[model samples]
Target chain A: MTVEKLYDAAGFKTISKGDGKKEVKAIFCCDMLSIAMSKAPASGCWITVVSNMNTLAVATLTDVSCVVIAGGVAVGEDMKAKAETEGIALFTCEEPAFETALIVHDLMNA
Target chain B: MSEVKLSYTISGDDFTRAGEASGDVKSKLKVLGVAPDIVRKVSIALYEGEINMVIHAHGGTIDVTISEKEITMVLADHGPGIENVELAMQAGYSTASENVRALGFGAGMGLPNMKKYSDDMNIETRIGEGTTVTMKVFLQ
Candidate 1:
């Protein structure tokens, strides 16, 4: 699913533009980078992380479809530049990540 | 190319800042074009180690080496050593305080999760001196 769809599913508001056409393979919900890495599905999945570049770094390494910063969001200039360079879409939302995940589950199921 | 080595200090005091090292490693591996699955394995294993450092060790140091064939990570801390290594390795075995559990960890899954995500892992400890964990994840 596109980042837009993900937000819509979670009933969250977008903070940045995202590639909404990106298809998602799986979803991960956690603030910890390691747990997310361990639990998140393989590439083609969408990851909702609560951390900053650190989370993006993990996403880049894992070849995720994109990263959606759910609740507490922080993305610095360096991280944005890196995400752009890596073709990793980084988006932020107003709602918490867990709630957003519920939306994602609904959307994916539908 | 030869194996590339990286090291970082893990702070046990800050829960919010715990995953910084793992994040850095994941990004570095991504930029280097390591396989995605291999990267995940490293990320998960190292992330678990980072949490362990904060929750149990108070802080520590991590050493990571990436080669064309394998990735190795060694995490060392001067915190109280594991009293029961075998039990700690269980999926539900945890000695983390209640506060840690409220923070979303201390569920006793750290070591088990680490082993599940890593190809190989070894742990060494002194009840008072500290604990050392060695983990490996392969890239095929």
Candidate 2:
């Protein structure tokens, strides 16, 4: 699915519309930057509560298609700006990570 | 022989900028048309090393050399050296404080992941001096 489609379907608040047409091949849920750095799939959607600069760095390194910030974590302005500059789609939802993953999983499989 | 050499000075005080160097290297590797899996491997290993430098070593320097056969990264830091290399290599062993864990790091997977991703890994350290990590990922 495309990032735009997931954003609309998941009801996530869009912070940055980076490459809305980018394809999302899978969904990964993890908060540990170390684990995500090595395990996150390329062109996949990353579901995490990590809303920091390093989160974007790992996302970029893993080539994740988009980052869905779960648990309504506050994202810093600098991080948002970096996401836009890096062309990484950023989204947020009040739901916790598992719930967020369920939403993404349903949409992705449906 | 054409080879690309890159070096960066990592600042220990800045946790937010920890992965900048690794991200830049990942981009460069991609631009060079390196395979995606290979790029990811190199990026992950280097990024783990970068984070370690920030969290434990009070920052450090990373030198990377990209050649046709392999990509080599050497990370050297002046902070307190690891007391036990064998234990540090074990997953789930960490000296990072609670604050570091709150940042979603300090899970003790840093060194293991670096070794897992790199084809060859080596660590050298002194009790009161410093530590240096050298890793290589072969381009097949």
Candidate 3:
């Protein structure tokens, strides 16, 4: 499914404009930047509560479909700016990280 | 002979700046039309190395050299060296602090991941002096 479709179904708030049509290959849930960078699929969506600038960096480096910050984590202004500059889609939701991953997984499987 | 040599210092004090050098190198390689797979390999290896420098060592320097045949990276740090390189090489071993783990790192996969992504990797260290990791990814 496209990122936009997932966003709509998952009820996530978009923080940056990206190609919503980008394919979603999988869902990788991890707060560890190194692990995500190493294991995240090319078109995966990373689910995490660790809302730091490095989150965007890892997402960009791995070429993930988008990043979903869970449980309404406070994203820094610098991180938002960097996400826009890097062209990586970012979103946030009130759900916890695990719940968010499950939602994305169900969406993908649907 | 092919070209491009770049070097950057990683500040141990700033966790946020850890991956900047690897990201820069990845962009440069992409601009040079390096193959996507090679770029990914180089990026992952260098990024893992960069994170290790910040989380373990106080900081370090990463030097990258790209030639027609391969891309090579050398990361050297003067922080507390690894007490046991073999144990550290084991997949799940880690000496990172709780604070580092809370940041979503310290899974003990950094070096192993680097080795997995690069075609070749080597390490040299002295317990008090520091550690230097050398890795190379072939263009072919």
Candidate 4:
């Protein structure tokens, strides 16, 4: 599904403007930046609770389609700026990471 | 063949800046038209080393050399060196403190991940003196 569709389905608020039309290849759920960087599928959506500039860095390096920060985590301003600069798609939601992951998984499987 | 060299200082506990060097190298390699797999390999290897330097060592210096056939990264640090190189290299062995673990790292996968991605890797360390890691990724 496209990022826009996923955003609506998962009820996420966008922090960075990625190509909303870009198709997501898959969804990866992890808070560890190293493991995410090593294992996340390129062009997939990353679901995590860690809200930091490093989150943006990992997204940029791995070329993820979007980052879904779950659990109502308040991402810092610096991280938002970095995400904007890197042209990475970053979003946040009130739902927990596991719940968001489930929604994304169902969407992908649907 | 001509080569490009880059260097950066990784400050200790500076989690925000940990991946800066590797990101720069990845961008340069992409601009140089290096193969995707090779670029990914070098980026992953170098970033792991950068994280290690930040958490274990009190920061360090990373020097990268990019040639037509290979990319070489040399990371050197002046901190408490590894007490057991063999054990440290094991997949699930880590000495990082709880604080480091909370940052979502210290999972004992740093060195092993670095080795997995690099074509060649070598570690030179002295318990009190320091540690230096050299890794190379071949372009094929």
Best by lDDT: 2
What is the DockQ ranking, best to worst? 2, 3, 4, 1
Q: Which stretches of candidate 4 lie over 4 Å from their true place?
A: A106-110
Superposed on all Cα atoms, the candidates' RMSDs to the truth, in angstroms, are: 4.8, 1.2, 1.9, 1.7
Cα lDDT over the full model 4: 0.86
**Candidate 2, residue A17: how far the Cα is off, in Å:** 1.0
Restricting to chain A, the TM-score for each candidate equals 0.70, 0.94, 0.91, 0.89
lDDT tens digits, residue span B1-140, model 1: 58899999987778756677887898898888987777777877788888889989999999999998889999999999999898888877788887676555665668888899899999999999999999989886
TM per candidate:
0.73, 0.97, 0.92, 0.93
The Cα RMSD in angstroms, rounded to one decimal, for candidate 4 relative to the true structure is: 1.7
Q: Taking the candidates in order, what DockQ does each have?
A: 0.25, 0.85, 0.71, 0.67
Record all residue pairs in model 3 with backbone atoms less than 3 Å apart, i.e. clashing. Answer: A31-B104, A32-B104
For candidate 4, the TM-score is 0.93
Question: Relative to the unseen true structure, what is the C-alpha lDDT of residue B6 in candidate 1, on a scale of 0 to 100?
Answer: 98
**Worst 10-residue lDDT window, candidate 2 chain B:** B99-108
Model 2's CAPRI class is high
Winner on TM-score (2 vs 4): 2
- For candidate 3, write residues B1-140 as lDDT tens digits: 56889999999958877789989999999999998888899999999999999888989999999999889999999988999888988887889899888777888899989999999999999989999999999986
- Please list the C-alpha lDDT of all candidates, in the order they appear: 0.73, 0.91, 0.88, 0.86
Residue-wise lDDT of candidate 3 within A6-101, one digit each (tens)?
Answer: 557656788886888999988888877778888889999889898887787788789899999998887788888888888888998789988888
